[model samples]
Each structure stands twice: as C-alpha cells, then as structure tokens.
Target: MLLPMSTAIAQRISLENHLSLETLRSGAGGEHHFNGMCQAACIASLLCEAGYGTAREGLFGEAERVLLDCRRAGIETENWRFDGKSYRILAEVLTLHDKQLSITPVRELIRANERLKTS
Candidate 1:
C-alpha cells in the first residue's frame, strides 16, 4: 500500500508480523493503509454480527465499525430502521468485503453515523 506523505510511515509497518510491504513497487503498492483498515473493519463487523467477537479485537478499524453496527442493530431491535445511513453502511461493508475496494470512503460511514446520532 502506498503510504502518503501525510500519513505516518509507521502505519506501513506491521507491528505483529514485523514485515514491511513499504518496500514494494518503489515504495508504492497502489493502495493505502486506511483502505485496508476499512476492509478489515468491514470483515470484523460482519464476523461480529455472525457471533464472532474475537475477530474485532485489536484491529485498527474495528471499533467504529462495531459501534456503527451496534447502533444499527439497536435500532432494528427497536423496530425502527434508518433509510440512509443503515443501508449505506451495510452496502459499503458488503462491497468492501467482496471486492476488497469500495468507491465509497469509509469515513462517510462515520459521517453518516454522526449525522444521524447513531453512534
């Protein structure tokens, strides 16, 4: 993944694996770490919804995704639903999980959540 000059270079290093993909492609992998975090978060949120809590632990992007999911689920349990933010999160998460890339920015999900007071 290409680490932009604006993002911390430290994010390129995997603290767990101790490997760096930073050296790939002249220090450009044609991807960004934030996108990876979004993909990872989507997967983690799905797994959590599937009753796998362990998947979310320690992942960089899982917290907010989980929070969003929790809010969505809470509304569903209350027999109410959001027309915009809920489906947007669901579609984006599924799209990212399937394609590993999304045209939608994950931050948009956060924004929608904030706008709706869902988180």
Candidate 2:
C-alpha cells in the first residue's frame, strides 16, 4: 500500500535522524527504556493490525531484543501484551524502527492511542 507523501517524508526524516546505540545506552533508565519499549510495541502492533506481516515480524524481533536488554539491566518488564500476545517493549521499538518497513501506520496508531488515553 502506498503511504501518504507527507508520512513517507516524515519517515525518511526519522531515518536520517535515527538514534545511535551509544545514545540509547547512555540514556538508558528504567522509565525511559520502558517507555521506548512500549512505543516500539505499539508501532509493531499497528503494522501487524494493518496486515504488514513482514514488518510486524521485524518489529516483534526488535522488541524481543530490547526486552532482553531490559532484563540484563535488572529491569522488570513482564506485563506488556498485544492482543493476548506478550511482548518486550524495547525489542518492539527496534523492530518498529527497521528501515525496510514504512512506519506511517505506526504513527497513526500512536496518535490513536494518545486520543484514547485522553478520552
């Protein structure tokens, strides 16, 4: 499916400004990392809901990795889920950021989530 031009451009900009591992590691903290992971899972879940299996798989893989990192750092993340499926937030974030997939739906999903939160 073709994404909106503005969304595509925004994705490109995000890719250009992608975060580095060093930056992520340096800023790693309990709440920040957890939030990042949640963001990743939300993105992946959106892509999966939109029928983008390949993108979903990639994002899910990344989320798993991030969760592993959380575990290594002695942070607990045992309750996150997507449609009854358990997920690690950090790994999801990595998967959601994969360059091979477009993140337009992910952005929309996030916005929807925000609306839901406020409503």
Candidate 3:
C-alpha cells in the first residue's frame, strides 16, 4: 500500500509530466503542440482569474516559463515537437496540485500527437 505522502508525490509527478508534455507539444511543428500549450496556459490563466492563488502562481507561472524557455531556445511556436524527458519533468511539477483542472485537455493534446505519429 502506498503511503499518503507517497501518493501525493506520485500525483505531483504526474501533473509535472503532463505539463512537460504540453511544452513539447508547443514546440512540435505541424503537430498542434504550441496551440495545446497555449490552451493549457489559458486554462491556468482562467484559474488565476478565478482566484486560485496557488494554481495561479504555480501552474500559470510554469506555463509562462515554458513559453519563455521555448522562445529562448529559438523554438518557434509554429515548429515545435515533443521532448519526452521534458514532458515527464513538467508533469512532475504539475502533479503537485490537489486540484484537477486544465489537465485533461493537455492530456488530449498529447494523445493527439501520439495519433499523428502513428498516422
């Protein structure tokens, strides 16, 4: 059986992983990754608008950083691709929240990318 703390950690990791996936998607060209990252950022922004303090700080903050990082890396929004390790790291960070909003769409975006790869 998993301890409560361990379970929480696991959840936190999952969230970060998803967020990283969002970042990768944002970078993948012809793959809708950037759009997906933007969508996730919007979701996080909405949470901030709703006054979820931690969510606003953590999620939205991370989203902003991801955007900035992409820019710094010279990764254009129009030509981005998923980086699996980065996705896992971001998902870990995202999992720290107790709430479960804005994650599903991100997951969908990842799935969509997977589909594209297979097709």
Off by over 4 Å in 3: 1-31, 56-59, 71-89, 92-98, 102-119
Give the distance in Å from residue 38's predicted Cα in candidate 2 to where it truly belongs: 2.8
lDDT of 2 by residue, 1-119 (tens): 34523556656634532342223444433444445544545554555566544553465655556555554554444432222122334433554445325545445555546754574
lDDT value, residue 83 of candidate 1: 36
lDDT of 3 by residue, 28-98 (tens): 34334444444445543543444432442465566566656655454444445545544543453344333
Clashing pairs in 2: 37-89, 37-90, 40-93, 59-95, 62-91, 63-91, 63-92, 64-91, 66-91
Candidates' C-alpha lDDT: 0.35, 0.46, 0.47
Lowest summed lDDT over 10 consecutive residues: which window, candidate 3?
96-105
lDDT measured at residue 13 in model 3 versus the true structure, 0 to 100: 44
Worst 10 residues of 1 by lDDT: 16-25
Clash count for candidate 1 is 0
Q: Write the per-residue lDDT of candidate 1 for residues 1-119, one digit (tens) a residue.
A: 22212223223322211111121112222224223433445544543443334332344253465435544554456322223443344334443333322222344434433544442
lDDT of 3: 0.47
> How should the candidates be ordered by lDDT, best one leading?
3, 2, 1
**Evaluation by lDDT, superior candidate among 1 and 3:** 3
Instruction: Tell me which of candidates 1 and 2 scores higher on lDDT.
Output: 2
lDDT of 3 at 54: 45
User: Clashes in each model (backbone N, CA, C under 3 Å)?
Assistant: 0, 9, 26
Give the CA lDDT, 0 to 100, for residue 60 in model 1. 28
